[model samples]
Target: MATFTTAFPRGFAIEVLDVYSGPPRIAFKFRHWGYMEGPFKGHPPHGQRVELFGVCIFHVDEDMKVDKSEYFYERGNFLAGFLSCPVMRGN
Candidate 1:
C-alpha cells in the first residue's frame, strides 16, 4: 500500500462501495482512482489516469486479528487504462 501511495503521489483515492460484516469475517467492495507519477509494474509514470474496482475479503481469528485476506480485480482493465492500449473488438 505504501509503495502504491508513493508511486501515485499526485493523486490516489479509494471509495468504499459496500461492506459486509459477519462474525470473524468482513468484505469490502471499493473503487480506486490513481494518477501515475512514478514507476508501476516496470512502467514509468506516464501521467495517465487509472481507475479500477475490486473486492477484498478478510477473515479474522477469534482474537479479532486478521488471519487471511483476499483481493480480486480485473488485470486487463487496469493494464489497458494505464498503458493506453487500443480497445479490443469482440469477435
Candidate 2:
C-alpha cells in the first residue's frame, strides 16, 4: 500500500452513484469502499505496477445534490501533505 498523509485541506464525504468503465457508460451501483482497495496485481496496459492510492469517489444526484465522497489521498494538495498519514494503498 502507498502510504499517504491524512491531512486533507478540503475535507469532504461523497457517495459515488456510478463509475464508467470501458467504452460504454456501464451503470454500476453502490460499491463499498472496502471492496475497491487494491494491492491489485495484474498487467495493466499502462505498463507499470501502480498501487491504488486509495479511492476518491464523488457522487452528485440528478438535482445536483452531493451524496457522499471520500479522498484517501496518496499524493494530494497542501495540508494533507503536511500532516501525518494513517492509511495507505495496497501493493
Candidate 3:
C-alpha cells in the first residue's frame, strides 16, 4: 500500500463499474487511476497517468464483514505503466 502511495503520491482514484450482492459473495468491477508524480522503486517520477481495470470478489461472514477477497487484473499491463514513461526509455 505504501509503495503505491510512493508511486502515485498525488492521489489514486477508483471508479466502481458494477456490483453484485449476495450473502456469500459480493463482486464488483472497477477502474483505478493515478498520476505517477512520485518516485517508484528506483524510477523517477514521470508525471504520467496510469490506470488499472479489474474485478474483485469478496466472501463475507454472516455479520456482513468480508472474510476473504479475490482480485483479478492484468499484471503485465499494470507493470507496463511504470515502464512506459520517457525516463525509462532514455528520452
lDDT of 1 by residue, 1-91 (tens): 7768766887678898999777577899988888877776555666778888999888988987899988899988766765642222221
Q: What lDDT tens digits, residue by residue, belong to model 2 across residues 31-64?
A: 2222222222231122122222344545556665
Query: What's each prediction's clash count?
Result: 0, 10, 0
Question: Higher lDDT: candidate 1 or 2?
Answer: 1
Candidate 3: count the clashes. Answer: 0
TM-score of 1: 0.66
In model 1, the worst 10-residue window by lDDT is 82-91
Tell me the lDDT of model 3 at 19: 93
Rank all candidate structures by their lDDT, best first, as comma-separated numbers.
Answer: 3, 1, 2
- TM-score for each of the candidates: 0.66, 0.23, 0.83
Tens digits of lDDT, candidate 3, 2-56: 9879888878998989997766899999888899998887788888888899999
Number of colliding residue pairs in model 2? 10
Q: Where is model 3 more than 4 Å wrong at Cα?
A: none
Ranking by TM-score: 3, 1, 2
